[model samples]
Target: AQRVTQPEKLLSVFKGAPVELKCNYSYSGSPELFWYVQYSRQRLQLLLRHISRESIKGFTADLNKGETSFHLKKPFAQEEDSAMYYCALSASSGSARQLTFGSGTQLTVLP
Candidate 1:
């Protein structure tokens, strides 16, 4: 079984401060990992992927295979960056793609 874990349910950060949202995963084989974010009143969208190696909206997450972690980070938090973030894992299971999501983390950037 594949599982994703987000340790914190909610994280509050001051504007201009650095932020990190913890995420961990367990899987038997190679897995595709992604971060999805939802802003207030906006639909959920893909933030970044472990394979993409791109930064979106000043947020980046590096997949650590050794620790089985993909923690999202931003150098400076902004009020506009406040949103709910989810860590998801996808892998082929018995000729079908299976996606497992972690409990989302709600980030609140206070100005």
Candidate 2:
């Protein structure tokens, strides 16, 4: 089963606290991993991709093929970063954009 799992349903902390959004996956074929985030009433947007290796909004994700995991992390989570975070994986067969998503984790940053 190709699946993405986010263990934490919700995480809340102070504005300067570190944040980590765990993600795990199971897939038979080669997979591309990505993280998507939704802030307040905004649309879900791509936070980062394992392939990109770029950090967005102080967030970075590393893909571990052996462990089948891609976790999002930031040294200090910000209030604006508070949002719904989803771990996703996609295949080459369908649209590159067609991703299977996890339920998601809601991150709250308090002042």
Clashes of each: 0, 0
TM-scores of all models? 0.94, 0.93
Those runs of model 1 whose alpha carbons end farther than 4 Å from true positions after fitting are 93-96
**Candidate 2 at 7: error in angstroms?**
0.9
Clashing pairs in 1: none
Residue 54, model 1: Cα distance from true site in angstroms: 0.4
Global CA lDDT computed for model 2: 0.90
* Cα distance off (Å), candidate 2, residue 17: 1.2
Q: Highest lDDT: which candidate?
A: 1
lDDT of 2 by residue, 1-111 (tens): 678999999999899999889999999998989999998999999888888789988898898999999999999978988899999999754455578999999999999
Worst 10 residues of 1 by lDDT: 90-99
Q: Candidate 1 deviates by what RMSD?
A: 2.2
Q: Record all residue pairs in model 2 with backbone atoms less than 3 Å apart, i.e. clashing.
A: none
